[model samples]
Target: MNDRENLCLLHSKDLLDQKRLFLLFKRLAGQHSVSIAKNIHETIKEFNSATFTEDQKLFEDLYKIAATIENKVIDVDVLKQGVNKLLDNRKTIPQPKPEDLCVNDSVFQNKILSKENNQKTAPVPAVYDMLSLLYLTTNEKQRQQHFHDLTKYYYRQLKDHLKQLSIELDEILPLPVYEKKIKDFIPNAKLEVILHYLNQDAKEDTFTSELIQELYLYVLYPKINIEDCFKIAKEVVGIDYNFLSYELVEANGLLGALGQYYKLKLTINKAGDDVVLNLFAKFMIDFPKDAFPGGEDAFPKVGDAFPKDEPPTLSLQEEFVYTIFVPELKNIGLGNICDFLPRCYFMRSSDVMVFEDLTYSDYEAVNSEEPYSYEMLLLVVKKLAKMHACSLLYEEITSKGSGETTKINVQFSKYVMGFSQAVDTKFKDTIHYCNVNTTVNYVYNQFPDVAKEITMEEFRERSRDIFDSMLDKMKTSGKYRNVICHGDIWGGNILFKFEGTRPVDCSLVDYQMIRYCPPAQDLMAFLYINTDKNTRTNYLSKLINDYYTEMSTIFKRYSFDLSTVYPYEVFMDSCEYMKSYAVCQAAAYYPSSLDRKKVQDLLGSIEKTVRFFAVDKTEVLKVLMKHDWIRSRFREIVEDLYDLCLQK
Candidate 1:
């Protein structure tokens, strides 16, 4: 406790600290070079065994080790921080009790525990106390609001940093500066690839085709190699063959609802006779940069909807639908499931999916611009009901085996339509800001009587509320006896197998948006998107009754009582609840869906249509209204939405 004893103790502690500092530097130097690390280790060992008289020489040796580390270390910032902390401590002697002189493991742990206890017992700041109380007292909504605000604040900061970086790079900053900054911001960021994507001057068609070709090569070639094909021919077909060439089949301007299609023809010599196998290739399309005149700036609200860095989730979702969902249906005794599902041949995770071409079997997709006739609609609705029944039966069978009954199968709990966060935000933003606004504005323009009850803003607000309410209901578990609802049930997604002029059978394509939701969601969505106002008015009740009857029949076949699971009354009520959802979706998609022109065609060739439902929506609306196809279809959608809002 005396000054001389304390001084001696401090001196001893300083030597221990010096040894610890050298050990730290030696560990860091290992990352730079093994030889340098060895030298520092030896110096520390020698210093540790040195007498008090040799302290000056050891101190000089330690300085040299520090210099070596400073020069060679890759992480200079961390090394500098350690060194600076040691330097700062040198000015004041650390007081340690006589028991602390040993610096053993027990003593170190005790010190830490003692420090923590002291900190805990210390007087607390009032602000921190208030914060703790607030956190404990706040409800879910309040906590969500706070978290949302914090997220938005952080996002703004991040966006500001990105904007500044963009500006600095535009001014031709030195490469080294950006290299350091970018790595600090985004670990393992590929500057070259990002820059290439931003600066490429390739024409739109060439760029898209090249991307598709690259994806096709990456996905299909790996699965369809020569050896694999030879094995397939010998084992499955009983004919050994030479794998020949493959070529892309031209569709002549056919565009998919959510993707681009390419029919691939593969030729192989079977018994010296040329045999051709057709493969249907579907590639998940991103929002091409050239499709927007001002690039992301054109869609300010959803600029990052399809960022180059993040791949689209459509292919992966559809892959799940094929590999997990439909296969499970067959496993659970739904023998006719494959009749409705295209035989998927090869599917990559995010971009490319290959299937046995359904067209080869006389299955043809309905025109995207045309509504399905009542007979065709009836067939499609019954098929949808069967799919729902199979999903229910599968859940029932699996739950019974597991001894736990869940409302929805655990595998199908997550919503698949907007499985990715980016896509979900984009969809919600498009629906709320673009779809809701456009539909309301159209109503205001075309139907003054429909718009008479409220202002345009009021109508937008009410429509948004209605759509949000539908989303809430959809998200609610055990809502209306959920089924595996085909999230995008429409004409474009259905393929009819015809016998001469009449349709004999049908198969649903594009299972990208399957969700565990009420069957009414699929039913209403089908009617709203693929049927005109007149068609729905004339045959809506009939179609619903047919869907119910088919579903009841399938359930009865599987020994399920429809009344015990999903009653007819409950299905009708769910349909009424989802009516607004269907209307909102129809309004959003009709502008693009009703037109024969592809998204790129309208945005690229038509200057005024560049901001279609993305930006300057009113101007684009004016241009769209000029077209009879969009105007007529969009009017029906808006009229339905307006009526739904009035009822609300």
Candidate 2:
């Protein structure tokens, strides 16, 4: 057919198909300018008017708009290819057989041949997909028809019409390609709807769907090379594999506070033998403003306190522990070098770290809700003790060889908490400033009898004072031997390997917050944060002594004595001195952990959390005190702090 006849045939389509055709022209026009696309659409939209005198006049109008688009378009061939495809679909319009009279008739027939009768009777591609296949490709931009300009009624009407054609979309298009197609047509399509048309199941909720969608993007679109995989396989399993393929499983429930976790399952071949490797991948989210929950709204409020300056190095520090510090300690081969650290499988830049999946050996984190029993606490204590002992051994050996006192070279060793120079703004912005102050205020107002003459302002000031004291106590000051401290020691960071009901092996997982301090920094934090006051009352000395005995044995293996290096007397004093710091840490952490439902209630609106901390804690404290768990936890913590700091 000629250009005039083809233009008349395209104009004969129903409004939806006409709009689809307009999208093709618009896509062509978009290659030049969005305004040109708008001009072309408006010009063609006038074609349906009854007042239109002749096809030649209307065709000339469209041709004029096309001429303007051609001037600005850099690739004239691509534009012609798009326009030619649209005309070809119209020129070959088939007359439906009488038996297929029920099928909706349009210029472009949406049909496929039936396998049973070898007849063109099957309804396969929906009109939307058929039109999509006619003009668009995977490389096309993700442009959608703007629904913002449409009325709500018209929008729903158009959506219902398109939904009918979405049924056969899956059979004709791959998910990723189809996703780009449907989203172009339905600009406001929910993730669930897109997944439905693509024949992929979405997570139940919008939040989860968005979260899983992001994870799929990261996993499916890995910026990796074959050489990286080969190197990882060689180093991890001692296999030089020439081939590799892998699947990533996002650990949804185990998502990190400031990052993401995945189980990287690999299949590789060497010498015609296939070997499977399962490794854990940790992705550090450097900027929480974009990747994390609460987005920009909640980030500014929490950013000051929550690793604002530390995220870039958070993974780096953990990577250093896995790749350098731990490996060097292991090379020394101390008698008590228990297998407590995950084996590093791969390290990608500074954001991603891969390690041996501990679950393969039946190791798993204990339930954070359950309090640690004596046995559980004992295993963790022993592990920490051995790790601390190794750090001491390294320092001692290095110092002796160099004939000088050598310290760990890790930069994270500098204390960042409390009233330190490194984190003056951090302390005032986060837990210490908001949560701690809130807890103390709630305690004083609710229990004036127990609060005594210590005024509310004094109590708040005392909290800061305790942290200021903690900064001083964190230093060795030639009084105690410094050992590497797991800066964050809590239930979540310890993974336990159990045999039936018996507690057996355990590994200390997150080393992102490692510090060079006395062992009391970790021990007290673990004891106070993970165990209850009653548990500590009954077994505190035993736990401490158990840690000391473990370290003492390890030291004796190297012909050194713990008594000289870290005396039991000095250890006891350090624990006493660090109690205020531990209590403060517990109070800061309890608001989120003790009753997450209330925390969620508080954080339901990021604005609420931001508002809660933006001003004085008076009103928010009242809101927080309503939750029974929050009330009890903060009350107990205040009592502990009061006795530690304000008791006469």
Candidate 3:
């Protein structure tokens, strides 16, 4: 009757809680804002009275959606006409006052409905149908989560409730309407609920209950409208009808066939609802482009569309992600992509590889106790330097476009975060790969030798200070217009196009973890991940030399003074400060070599630095004095970090 009571429907949970349910129904359905319809309260009450049992929120969310539909219209007459229909429909349903329900379930009435066991108690039996449609239309992840949330408490109660309503059909209604009405309420229920409710001999029960009759009517007398069926599919069920040139299941969004991919509970929906797939297309997720013969970097600018030479069945999505018809892995069409450059075999998903043209044992030796070769190490260093070069001059690289692309990218970060909760336990429960808690601790532990190395009590403060200092430097370099860099430049994407040891070109894939930061952040992280403590010590001098040579070459073309831009001392200082990234990466990625591709990807980075170079304490001081990039402002940061530990 009043506004406050109407809002209470949202808080009400039980079907028997008539007053609260109707009140919430009125508030949710009557208007877009809280304004009431002329007879909103009366209509809801009537609907509750006539319906076999009451369902509050389900009716309300549907009516609310319809009302939302009506409100978007500009014409008041049209809106009123729509509202009048909803009201009339509710009146046709029976209403049960609050006194009619089971009194003991008050607390239950205030909680949310169990979607699995929820009853469709509205007078219009179609109300239940609409609710089912809503459930079907929800995305797979959300649907699963809701399904999971409801499985424990109320599933059996909803099942039993359907049983009781079937028995009283004849006693409650006229003969002609009795059988039909009961069937409409609990159509297609299992036999036990029916026999128990009817309590009649199976032979004597020739006439089905109204709920059963509705099931038979639906099955034997199906609604037959071909055009309308498609509309029902696309609009009510949320299926897209767009067709690609080939059935690339990965890119196609396989409706529910994801059971076919790498195993997990993650099902690709053919439409938004049923896991049942249509014959026209195979629902999938490993993007067709990901499996294309070339890596994303090597894919030719305009010509890399799926090759037409193959018959309809062998598109890249089907060929790579699932199965292929090729004679061997090599014949699977990398040659079809480009013939000149040697492509390394690596799976970004599971980085296992064996190449037809590989010469160096180092690439294949990803499994060796020593994972890298001298030539492979050189390639890894060169790539790190190149990744840094991109970030160092991001604006100049992107200057050509109205807004040209820079290297920094984190489009996949959101997906990575989402995977922690929704993806399988294999990923979410991973100790190293996605453990945020482990990562923070790892960063806290590295460089403990320094006095006051950011106490645990002071971690947040230290992190803020470190990031602020780094950003401050970034602002001055290229004047706060730094190039975007790959935030996670670990060995996952460090392997290259090589004829064994002779690396033809370096390519980076899995752009999912990209970010913008100082150029040296990636370089330091590469050192941390690729080399051990021993190797880091041995190669610090040579590594520094390699980076300087590559960086200086890039800087010379841009007319910046390499000596002044990122000087040797500044690079070492950046390493000391940024080395925490290695700790974070190790915690997230270390123990996860379970998959072949993942192991190869990680070891590929490690191969660069596994040569066991010993650290020399004296070299650090000599390099600091000789290099000029460490500006006067940065002296305190280097001094504080250098004091953390002396090389043995």
TM-score, one value per model: 0.58, 0.57, 0.32
Q: Rank the candidates by TM-score, best first.
A: 1, 2, 3
Question: Which one wins on lDDT?
Answer: 2
lDDT of 3 at 607: 19
Pitting candidate 1 against candidate 2, the one with the higher lDDT is 2
The C-alpha RMSD of each candidate to the native structure, in angstroms, is 21.2, 18.9, 22.6
After superposition, candidate 3 runs with Cα above 4 Å error: 1-365, 397-482, 497-505, 558-560, 564-568, 593-648
Error (Å) of candidate 2 at residue 272 is 5.8
Report the C-alpha lDDT of model 3 over 575-613, residue by residue, as the tens digit.
Answer: 555565444443333323112333333333211112101
Cα lDDT tens digits for candidate 1, 81-164: 433343344333233222111111111112222233342221111112212222222222232224223222322332344344
Weakest lDDT window of 10 consecutive positions for candidate 3? 608-617
Top TM-score model? 1
- Candidate 3: TM-score? 0.32
lDDT of 2 by residue, 1-648 (tens): 332233221211122343544444333222212222223223221111111122343333332333443213223344334334434443453542221112121122222112212333222112232232222211111111222111122223323432454422122232323323332222112211222222212123232232223222323434332224445666765534444355677764452344567877777666788878888878765543432233444332322443322332445456657766776776776534846677777665445677888999899877545568999999999989988888888888777877988677433343222222234334234534565556566555676655566775776677667756665655444566677777777766788889999989889987766666778888988888887777888998899889999889888889888898777898899887778878878776664455444454554443454444433445645676776655665667777877766742
Clashes of each: 0, 0, 45
